[model samples]
Target: MAKPASIPGLNPEILAWARRRAGHDVATVAKRLRKSPEDVRAWEAGDASPTYVQLEKLAYEIYKRPLALFFFPEPPEEEDPEHRFRTLPAFELARLAPDTRLKIRDACAKQIALHELTGGRNPAERLVFRDLASTPDSDPAGVAEKLRDYLGVSVEEQRSWRSAAAALARWRESIEEHGVFVFKSSFKQQEISGFCLYGEEFPIIYLNNSVAKTRQIFTLFHELAHLLLRLDGITKRDDSYIGHLRGEEREVEVFCNAFAGAFLVPQGVVRELAGRGAPADDEIKTFATQLKVSREVILRRLLDRGVVSRQHYEQKAAEWTDDYFERRRKSGGGNYYNTQGVYLGKRFLALGFQQLYRGVISRAELADVLGVKATSLDGLEQRMLAGTG
Candidate 1:
């Protein structure tokens, strides 16, 4: 066999930096690259270097970084994304899955690119809730009211949507109308519900599509609370960690949770429902159905208002949680284009398509941004356009 040619002047530190940045250990990288662990260690330790083809595979395929980075004299000083956002602690944020981190980084890059493409122009009209005067000590119900008004989506309007999916679409559109871009992706991890990337020009919210639509609705508002507060970071709303958080971190979570619940199921509506007497499981379901929220949300509200006992609330919550996951598992898969539409979001796709049409970005670049193949661009564009109609 012919020997592969080597690339001179490759920095071993850069190779190590890329691997660490992708959250991959030497063993994992070796497995992915079909190389021995010793070989991977040798390459990183400057004892041996990869050939050009191996370097390309390592850069683009394995680490998902630019090939040019390998030539840098030293590892670039990359900012900790969590530090730029006050929503979560650095340690907690670092615990996210590698794919989740990459998705976030990609989303942030797209946002920055969009901002630059548009010449840094701000949205013509500002979101009313963008300047909300609520604090951690502020009334959650009042804050919810303000957000509802800003969104201009009434409970009657929401109920009239007739289905959870429809209601989610309506709410997402309304929020996007106010200049925020919402995207969905399957985190493939249960702990992370959703996250937001706060930006002055174009803020972004990401929902985990693997969850139930009702749960996604709650996540939408939860992330809205983050954007409204101008905080950015990933959110893992797993109950196990809630009790461990303290101070501002805990307060932020509590406030966002309360605001999301209150925004979806208004306090007055909960009070009125409870006035009829303690709600049964069916009644809770009915309330959730009417409000277009998850039963878990309504049950929490009931527990807070003394309408349901702690034991009853916990039992119902556990049952609903289990049922939700089972349904998710049994629902099987959906159409690829449809799922991609939901994942990329109409607003973000529209922006990308517009850029393509204006010759600001090439079709190849558009495909890259949309995370689809160049050949798939035509159909994706058609689906996106048809969706807008």
Candidate 2:
């Protein structure tokens, strides 16, 4: 009989650290590794170790860390991502899905790559909108007008768009043109709408693609509010947490929400359609169609201006919310390459490929930066060049 394989010794602290940093519990790690929770606990407790083959999988696949890190005398200190970006409380942030955590880390790495590729130059130097700053106390309507001019997304231009999806694409492209990297992901959790990472060189805004296109449009502006405020943070549209906030926290949330509404459904346009009376369902739908915003957005704006009663607004908002999610559930995901283009913003991929083509980075390096296999680069390049992805 062959002798039993020897397990490699690893620092137990590093084992524990990697799991925690990945936001995984023992059970989760065990399930991914096809082991029992007790086995994972034993590894972390220094009572047992994974074999050489198992260690490689744990480091590369499970923990997504370097194998050398496991030999450290102590787990190296990792910067709390929550500190760099204003997010929920630490406990709440830790509860974020592992996939979300991984995506955040991947985005951070990609931002670093962009910064290096640009020779540490500030890409926002030429972006007029990056300098457009505002405070929570600023007038939402005024700020919205400035942003519209900066983005060149006038109501007239928006009216010419073929559909809401087209408007969304145009808006995203406009923002990316201004030097912000806008990407989308199908987050499993419904609570998280989007997040922004503030940077002088490559600020990033990530939108949840699983939601309705209209909601994603709203979130796009909401994150833009964060970028304008220079407030890097994660955003969730869940109404349950509203009552829990107070003072500045509450003010920031309210300001961003109001800014998104004003930006999408300009007050002037709202007044033009709404006049002095409560708007009917048909009127709300008409405004929503013309503005390319959700009916809930129009209703909320009317509610704020006393054009709609609170009771009526609440009923309409709830109904619209339910219908939106139901429709999203029934809709089929479209083309894969197109979805990939949305996932990895066109501008981002363009920059990565430019670097690759210029020999500034190797194909392997580009794959690492873009988070794809090196073999997949050729296909991705073909799709991107054809404007299919």
Candidate 3:
């Protein structure tokens, strides 16, 4: 690119933002840009100016703000009154997807029209989750780095599935720019493991009550991938199943899968554990055990990386998934997803109760907050008090 004529004027705000966003010393940017650090500092201080060519290159490489932001006087940041991150009442999300919480309010505004048309049924409530409904601008690689930093776990941190789940919790905690929530309930007759409520603070994850501990862990990560992709939608897959979608949803799903795979079993770490070479079926199982992920997940990863074949992966994965269901059925022939919901939901409810008793809120209101009957809250309170006393 030809360097343009030196411009007489430049915006200080633009240079300052680049300095802060890069989080590096002015000297560093100068060295990389092959300019004197003093000049860089002067440019930021609005004492020196860069040519149009230099400004264009700087704008593209760092900060990524449009050239207009530098010149235009920025209006003060307007904060939205309804920040979705705040805790909302449970009735607001009953059987609803997280992403549509905002829309749900709008629907309520048209309640008379909607109720007259649908006869008091709100099917859209259940369909509009936030996790599968977001629009993320960053790529998977960028998201992976953000997740690692947010969770405070290194890409090299290979641990148990439980530990990985804990890491996911940290990731949720790290998300300040976006909203996330865990929606738990004893969903009778529904086989849903969990769904994301995309683009809402109160994103819903519907955990099924009937799933095994191992399977539930996988579902947690799978739904999390939906969140990263900002997809406002639903996804159901058997263990280690890669979605073969097309179009916009396909792009997001692919990115989600990549994020989940990296978070669960980082490529570099897995490659090292595989002895820097492909391992056999038995060896892959051993690796899975070591990684604290399902054998199918590991096998698929290996196969995708050319460490295994389609035939080898499917043959082994089918056996594992089949035997898994068989063993689970033998122990208790119940819906796996529903079972998880009840167990985890009870725990979450307990926390909600404590928040109530502390006078942080009213008992009736707390029940309302969680979408449970007042009688249910009273019963749970008695049980909790009895157990403690």
Q: Which window of ten consecutive residues has the lowest lDDT sum in model 1?
A: 233-242
Writing each residue's lDDT as its tens digit, candidate 1 over 176-266 gives 8787778888886676888888887788888888777888899998888877777774566454465667887777778888888899998
Better of 2 and 3 by lDDT: 2
State the lDDT of candidate 2 residue by residue for 218-278, as single tens digits: 8988888877877776777554454566687667778888989998988788788678487
Query: In model 1, how large is the Cα lDDT of residue 346?
Result: 81
- For each candidate in turn, the TM-score is 0.90, 0.89, 0.52
Q: For model 2, what is the alpha-carbon lDDT of residue 53?
A: 78
Please estimate how well model 2 matches the true structure, expressed as its whole-model Cα lDDT: 0.79
How far in Å is the alpha carbon of 346 misplaced in model 1?
2.0
Candidates in order: C-alpha RMSD to true structure: 2.6, 2.7, 21.6
What's the CA RMSD of model 3 in angstroms?
Answer: 21.6
Better of 1 and 3 by TM-score: 1
* TM-score (C-alpha) between model 1 and the true structure: 0.90
Runs of candidate 2 exceeding 4 Å displacement: 1-9, 53-57, 84-94, 122-125, 309-315
